[model samples]
Target: MTKELLTGNTAVALGARLSGVEYVPAYPITPQTEIIERLSRWANEGAMDARVVTMESEHSMLTAAGAASVAGVRTFTATSSQGLLYGFEMLYNIAGWRAPLVLANVSRGVASPITLEPDHNDVLSARDSGFLQIHAETCQEALDSVIMAYRIAEDDKVRLPAMVNLDGFYLSYTREPVDVPEQERVAEFLPPYRPQSGYMSAKNPMSVAVVVLDGRAYSYFKYQMHLASTNALAVHEKVAGEFEKAFGRKYPAVEGYMLEDADYAIVITNSLTTTARAAVQEMRKEGKKAGLVRIRLVRPFPRQQVADMLAGKKGVAVFDQNISVGSGGILYPEILSALYHRSDRPKKVVSFIGGLGGKRVGHTEFRHMVAVTEGCVRDDSQLASVLLFTDSDWQAVKGMLRTAGKGEVSQ
Candidate 1:
């Protein structure tokens, strides 16, 4: 193993190459394109042995990779917000077919007004689509998660597609020192893909993409897919354990820092967790028992494990990069449901939203969010679920509107 400075996307590309992937069908999409671009360049330079095919659209890209996967070889692909949605139908179909393909989805918010930035909505919107998900907080995790993704996806009990998520500009573009494992060591960790049945071969011509006759049959098959996805929870833990032994790094389903006896904490994911951790340290300096629970595996939900982590805290704030339109923070509500029936559930929990559309969420935002959570605990009050706008956020918008009106009247 050797330490090298690499961007998240570059790390991901190397992760796939090192995983012994034989096929990659993909299209270029912002924040996600670099991954495919790197692989494409490597294959062209004769450094990587893989088939990198460029398709017309994300939909075709997913279709090609999905077909290649069930044909009995390892495959990979990637996309961001709009590209992910564009290939949405094929995602469900591939999962149902139980193809063990690995995909990297660099998170980005969906567009209406249109902006390029990172958010969980692009990923969370597909939470129930029968794919295992790992949200990485650092460039190292981004690389390791992609490697682990292949192991988990190809597991017999969890023969499904897997998605490894990283924040768009945040982790995607940021450089960090990552431990690049040797290909020999990675080979020892990840086994070759060999499915039970339905492989593409002239000697064994098996029917592919057969039609299901009735709703009852479809429901039963879908339930089977659900069971396979849930099986990933245990599979992930096992893979993560072996990964550490192989690479000398540890990655759990949920990473809890200073949560053992904390009275308050923050539940967050991806790159922002770094800032939250620093914020917790500052709070600690001030004699506050603040901590952080960083989510690693989001799908399969890890509900029981997460509940165990947050149950005894006096209060906790949820940091979400994605909004659920009329509802609230997508992760916050799900977390509430997880802890609701627990005897030791926290008395107060609040949601704080920021970092959408590539907005910077730094120390100032972290301080504000932590303050709100602590105040909620002290007052024993329930706060509204969304924190979309602060007094200052609104004031700035109002100031812009005033300037626009003045210019219109002067004209």
Candidate 2:
């Protein structure tokens, strides 16, 4: 066991090195470039036995990763925001072919009018692309999840690509103390890659990721993908348990902090949970019962665990860094769907959209989010609204709403 202060990118690099990744397809993108740089330095120094391929673009980068993994090498890659989108086709192709490649997605905001900041939109957009998605809340998890992603991706029952995402600027550059296990221990936990079925050879040639038959075949393929994702929930827990046996830490799909006896709670993901934790602590000190649920695994949705955690609470607030256009927030609908069928549910479930485009979400802003939820619990008529925007923006929003009223058109 070795403890070192490292930025999230370095931790991921160290984790990949420890996991004995044999190949890395490198492409530079903001927030994720440091990871490739560190891995290249390690490879150059002979610290890791890996081939680093500098590709011209993300599309080529992922294609190389998929090809390398299919060639029976444990492969890894990193990308962000538009980079992921640019290589979207390769992502689906990798999963469709059941190729196990580990992807470290340093979460960055998507572009219309672009800004490089931490947001979930980029990763969330790929939620349906048949890859296992895990969101990291800390530098340690960012490191640990990479190792787990490899294990999960290679499992015979869930043979698919895996993506481990960390918030862009907040986590990628933030320095924190991380425990990087010895290479021997990591090897013991995650053994060297052994592909279940060897790659395409002249003796056993096969077409990988070819287009399938009709709608029935397509539906069957999708159904099998769903089953794989569903099976991943249990695989994740088992892998986390195994990781705990090797390292002294355990992580769950959904982690609840002080939720057992709390009257209200906030659900969050990524680095924002750290800020929300402080707010929850203050609320606890004031004798106002508030707890927090941080989702480590976003895809496969952890519906059961989340429903159980929020059951019987007075109020629940979900904070999303990404919006779904006219909808409240992306995670908001999922959380609501999770709790909808439950007989006993939180009194008021509110959605608060904040921290878009890497905007700072301070303790004050978190407190305001909590206050809004509290008000909704008290008077059930507060009406759903997005928090942490300027008052002038609300005026503009109101004008748009009025002009676009129920089938109304603007000239």
lDDT of 2 by residue, 1-411 (tens): 889999999998888888899999999999999999999998999999998889999999999898778778899999999999999998888887778889999998898868789889999999989889999989999999999999998988898899999999899999999998988888988977888665755576778756777778888878888899899999999999998888989999999998999988999999999989998899899898899999998877899999999999988889999988877789988999999999998888988999988887887777777788888989985457575687765677578778877444343
Q: How big is the positional error of residue 365 in model 1, measured in Å on the Cα after superposition?
A: 2.3
Report per-prediction Cα RMSD to one decimal. Answer: 2.4, 4.6
Off by over 4 Å in 2: 392-411
Error of 1 at 72 (Å): 0.7
For 152-250, candidate 1 gives per-residue lDDT tens digits of 999998999999999998888889999999999899898777776757756777775788786888999899998998899999999988988878889
Clash totals for all models, in order? 0, 0
Q: Which model scores highest in TM-score?
A: 1
- lDDT for each of the candidates? 0.88, 0.89
